[model samples]
Target chain A: MSTSADTVSMGGGNNSPSIRAKVQAFGGFLTNMVLPNIGAFIAWGLLTALFIPSGWMPNEEFAKIVGPAINFLLPLLLAITGGRMVGGQRGAVMGAIGAIGLIVGADIPMFLGAMVIGPLGGLIIKKFDGLLENRIPAGFEMIVNNFSLGILGFLLMLVSFEFIGPVIEAANNGITVAIEALVATGLLPLLSLINEPAKVLFLNNVIDQGIYYPLGMQAAAEQGKSIYFTVASNPGPGLGLLLAFTFFGGKTSKRTAPGAMIIHFLGGIHELYFPYVLMKPLTIVGMIGGGMTGIAVFELFDAGLVAGPSPGSIFAYLGLTPKGSFIGIIAGVLAAAGVTFLITSLILKMDKNTEETEEENLNESIEKSKAMKQEGKEVSAASEQHTTQIEKISFACDAGAGSSAMGATAFRKKLHKKGIEGIEVKHYRIEDVPEDANIVVVHKDLLDRAKIAHSDKEIITIENFLDDPNLHGLLERLENVSK
Target chain B: MLGEHLKGNVRFLESVNSWEEAIRESAAPLLENGSITSKYVDDMIQNVNTNGPYIVVVPEFAMPHAKNENSVEKTGISFLQLQEPVMFPDDKEVKVLFALAAEDSTGHLDLISDLSGVLMEDEARDELKQAKSEKEIIDLINSVE
Candidate 1:
């Protein structure tokens, strides 16, 4: 089942999940917001590539779809999705209303602005809904709900409409000017310094969506292609790094790196190659060198893609490539991979005298990345000092037959009543609480067994499954976090 | 589904000497009907001995069960209402026991859902607790269903 754990930080009151976990969770959220609407981007990219005046098939009628789709439809979808993540269905509606303002206000497409405004609108409605909790009279719930959203959405539309104009004007000047400065300086390849490490730490989304996409879109709007999109997403470095490990790594790493290479290069999932780099941290030098070469090549050729290549796969890169950019794009990817492989192979050969073994690092990095991925699923874990937003709560008992089932069911009912979203309540045996669970709840009597089963976890003990003081505290804490 | 499973599996008892005896007595109906073997009853008691009184899920309520381990022939639920509360580990005073014999985890969920519904609301819990006879218990559980 596609559970909602990956994008939210689901932790209990006591757990202190690592900072890496929080970043992955936020990255997961951003990726979800953009990944779903990528089809729209591709459709627009296809239309633009095929039917624009300079294109091979240049159909005026088909090309008409490109402008409106990127300008209105794509941005609206992003805003709607952003809203739904924060506020649910109603939030989605609010996000669209808010985003329409930015689209009309800005001279350019509002991808970056829509991303910000969508969540803001969702938060606005979610907070408003939270306030309206228990205050609505029973019979007037329908009318109050309708009028409230209608009235709030009307004002939100106006606020965003007016607010977006000034925000876009400032952003236009800021990003466009900064980018032009960077282009003139010829130091774009230095971005690999940030991109390589951030990718391994699960910040690929942040640097891609947060920095490059906006820059690329702006430059592309003017020149039909920009080197910005290819800077961070080039998969060549990962390919080189993994290929090096496949040839020169320890026994386990050598065996594993080949499979990872396939998934990373052709599959375009850069995450597949991270374990290799993490196992041999020094190999990052090779990745950085590869990335720099790729960027330099792209800049030299003045090559770019029509759309951002999500997953960073070679296939996606080729698909999104503008007609004349093929030569340069392919050259950049090959050059980057070749450079990274050469450097990585040299490092692996030299590191034979080091205390660290490639297998050990590989194993630890695999485990660490898994931990980070799980945390990413935990939607919005606020902090340990404050009550964290919980996503998965496991109700554990000796058999997981009767009592735990009853506890999970009752807790689900409470969550439903309180309008808490994204938390998964399920019954599990004391020994079988899933690795993804943010908290484990057990009857106080079984504390010893639970401790023995999961010594690493935070345990919530209760005397009564239905009505316990501790459970009451957790409910209050959850309510506060959601608010 | 729960009411059907619990039809001939309900019992009312005056008392039991120990929590182990309470589970044996509660599961007696399921055992006699071939839903589970005597080993299932012993394993349910052994579960508490090893894990303590966690089976006493709420005040005055306990659900005794263990891994089927090939001891269960069919899934079934049996309820027993003790006239006087029996002392369990951790000094839990339990007056009701729901001895579960599940063939597998997912198969017995309908019955579990019915039981949760019965216990979730204060009014329904009080109603089930006040029930006197086997028919009354079955009727109360069914009402929630």
Candidate 2:
């Protein structure tokens, strides 16, 4: 569960006149700020683009200088800039320090490192910024305050990079190796079997962070030479569907899927099929199967492209792809679609039976519970009495503040629509919630605290309050309680 | 050290017609003041023309700068803002500019980072944008807590 206040409070006091002024001044500073290193990047890019092509500089020497600088320095600058954008001077210094880890880490691209580390660095600095601000004394405030604070922030940023950089590097290495091994074992058939059903029916594409893109990009980046290959290899279950439809799909899927695929392809967005996957989980399985097969075929042919594969649609593939891998790409698409379609058709027939059995089991549990209540058991009384006391309720989610605040907003909207008032509604992070709260709602993943607090109050599990109708009903019941 | 680098040379501009004009216009003062050389201004203009609007480095802010060695008459800072918001293709919005003139890369690194921090805050950024006069802008800059 998330609440509006939690979300709203994360940015903290943007409405304050002074804070607004700070933001404006900071924006001006960033706009007018100059870094000499950027010229290094421009000069490097120009030399590489012009001289490298004309054979003025040998490829080996060019790669040594240009590759490391563009990959490392440019990202370092981005991290510093991003941090400054987020946290001001402290953030900029912190972001730059954090970005330095990417150069040392050497595995992850600088742009990606900057994108991740800069924000993380800003967040860490933001956590301590208030504490530092509070400790500044009155007399020497102007000199001692920002100066010491800047030094402290810079040191903290360096320490954070030292600690976090290794963990990130190890994790990247682990994932890369795992993906490589999976591809090398020629396990596409088994993967296709699992993936097709997951893609078509379970909304596998919705969890790109968990699947597809990470694996694809990791494999491509680790195995391939060019940046273009890394970009082109973005594995998307949605792209799996498009490849299936365009190259080998039946008439019905071909027409509808192509239009949606085109939008995602050009835009570099791949989450467009979430609604479709939710409605038909079987289709998702097909997509997963297709993705697995695609990777396998791609490996077999040793095809490569430039750039990371974010916009994983075909148009981006063709438009940005380096010359001479068309056959490999075609083969990869066919292999993916063939494997996906086969696996999906077989699994779709079996799912209907499983779904019926699951429904029956749910009904059986409800009947059993009702029968137990009719027997006047004291255990039933505990549940009944507990439900009665939950008039006012609140919950928490990630960032404890922001998501919880958003949840509170949704809960209130639902409460209003049902004409339920007088039941106080609030949101908090799990860390900040009061022990006296009568009813607490929390994300299913973060239910440990709620369970512990359950000794005093009833706890409701919510999968995300944003659009959960079932959660709205549960909230309505809790709010309608007279006590 | 950051304050020393920033003193006297920083200016608050009223407005400019476009991002290109803003850079050229903003750099003019720093060039005349002997804080930077004409070559620095030329390089910044060229960088912007070649690279898409990477200068709008912060939200509602743009920094028009080039390689420090190109300009470096003396290490300095200049501030400018548009009467109307200018578009940086990469940025969401633009109103303020910080044109930096560093003699070398290492000389102003710390000051550049420190100055970036001050301007990154929404409160500071808005204050600078709303300043009616150079005195107010300088006061706001001096008032950073």
Candidate 3:
């Protein structure tokens, strides 16, 4: 089967094959990272709901243990994750601090607050990361400077949360109230139109602004009002795409479409079907038509979801939805299917020439690869000589403290696993190097600095250190020499 | 029972050099009055190190108390304010400490809730912030319905 990777190489012009490879890799990376955490969170919830109320655990003791753990430990974990997401120790520390602020500063429960705070923390960390990179002193060691900058970043976040958190909280609450009123007015039809296209194109923004911002939507639902709304609300367009594929997609698409549908149904990750929709833009019109149909069905059945959907899976619908609304669920799904299938069929028929063009591009990419390979000669170094040289390894990152430390640790571990020896691995900020380092590792954006500092050194550029598995193996080889 | 026992032991301070000093000074009367033990104060300090700035759970309000067994000669509350705010490195905001000494954890819920309610009110907080004398501060606290 020709995957998107194969297609990318074939369609090459200005678009590099690596870009598509990265996108595919990140999609899998994100899924692996988040899915386990989701399971952990749900298990915690179930344990609390079942065991605490049943008197298996003492409330005071549980509060003492859970309260402090949730307040401190959870934020730290979030910071680490956030740091990994952005690629540095500083981002992780900032993320952790920001998560702490959200956890402590807001009245929302700790677990729920994490979902909102983790990303905000990532953004804050990213901002400071840029600021710190710009202000690095000319002579100081990059790692040491990053460590000091991290302390300053932590202090800044602490102050901001203390004095500024209240104002931000107030503003956030006001927005939440406004959104609740909009949702309660049953303006689903209008919202569907605006939100359907948004769901397809700008999915992340919709998740951030439309869904995650209002942390207490479930609590607000108890009051019979909430402002948060999205097309992912009921039988969302993502599900519509799945249903369309099941009923009307080509033989290959139909076979795979059911798994995507099941994932959307049970897992609540509607984005699982994004590839299918992106492959066919005509599916957008189908999504809108399905969305409108779903809205009408929701209104007809009087089925409502307390929390706005980002995941938009059947399990979340069952969890947050009011009881005994099976008919509403079914009607919404059917409406979406009806609209999507009709629209997708028309679009597919109109675009029959696209396949021929794709094949021609594929042929061109193979020719280009052959030519490039012929021009690039292979190395002729003796294996014994290459093994003996002490490879001076250096890392250049956004912040030198948190994620860099983690990366260093991972690198050392990898080196041990490889059973290689005689490597000196050290982490540096973008500009600092001891002049004799044999290998310089840096983020893609910091390549210019790496080029300037270690013009003689072999440079390995990474997009995000935390996300790349190959970097781990490379670091491991470097560490083997040190051991 | 903890609040009733500690009522006469609570002390009020006008200013202090640091949050640590404020905590030690406020807990002194409780210690002297045999309302709480010195070991309890030590534990509270240790707690702060392990857990960052939980005392400043709310704005301008800090509730510093240890476990029931730490000292607890009796239950009591202490109020301390600085002429200028003292910075706690753990928290970015300047805190005027409102330390509570409890003999046990459970009995003082009503008293804790009452104090929390009074602190939660904006007008009472403003009045508390403005008070120049210990007597004035006491009067302001007593005035909460």
Candidate with top TM-score is 1
What candidate 2 gets wrong by more than 4 Å, as runs, is: A1-65, A74-89, A105-117, A134-146, A157-163, A188-258, A265-268, A338-483, B1-145
Query: Which regions of candidate 1 deviate over 4 angstroms?
Result: A1-18, A354-356, A379-483, B1-145
Where model 3 places Cα greater than 4 Å from the true spot, the runs are A1-36, A44-80, A83-94, A108-154, A202-283, A293-335, A338-483, B1-145
Candidate 3: deviation at residue A416, Å?
33
Where is the poorest 10-residue window by lDDT in model 1 chain A? A1-10
Tens digits of lDDT, candidate 1, A48-122: 778887676889998777778878998899899999887778889989988988888788878888888898888
DockQ of each: 0.47, 0.01, 0.01
The interface root-mean-square deviations, each candidate in sequence, come to 1.4, 16.9, 18.3
For residue A254, model 2's alpha carbon misses the true position, in angstroms, by 8.8
* Complex DockQ, candidate 2: 0.01
| Best-performing candidate as measured by lDDT | 1
**Candidate 2 CA-lDDT value:** 0.53
lDDT of 3 by residue, B1-145 (tens): 3234334544445567777776787567667777678887876666455444445534555556655554566667666665666666444454456566655433454455456545546787777667766666666666663
In order, what lDDT does every prediction score?
0.80, 0.53, 0.52
Predicted complex 2: CAPRI docking category: incorrect
The sequence of per-residue lDDT tens digits that candidate 3 reaches over residues A1-483 is 123223323423233434333333333333323443444333333333323333235365553444354345543564456444553455556666666665577664343344334545555554555445425556665775567557756764676467545655666666667655755786656655555544433233334332442343433323321223324554456666777666656555666778878887667665556556555545666666777777667666765544444455666655544333456766676676677667766765566556445344324434443332222211101211233244457765433322233334345445545765445566655466577777777655556766877788788765434335457556554454334
What TM-scores does chain A show, candidate by candidate in order?
Answer: 0.78, 0.48, 0.50
Candidate 2 per-residue lDDT, tens place, A1-483, comes to 022223212222122333323333332323222232335433544444333333234465554565565556666776776676555566777788777856565556544456567656765665555345435565776787567557755665566467666666676667657655755686633454444333222222222322343343333334332322322234444555555444443344445567666675566555444333333334555665566667666667766543334335566455434344566766775666567556555554454445434334334433432332223233233333332245357765422333344456556656666765445566665665676567777755557755665656667766534545557677655554422
Q: What is the lDDT of residue A263 in candidate 1?
A: 85
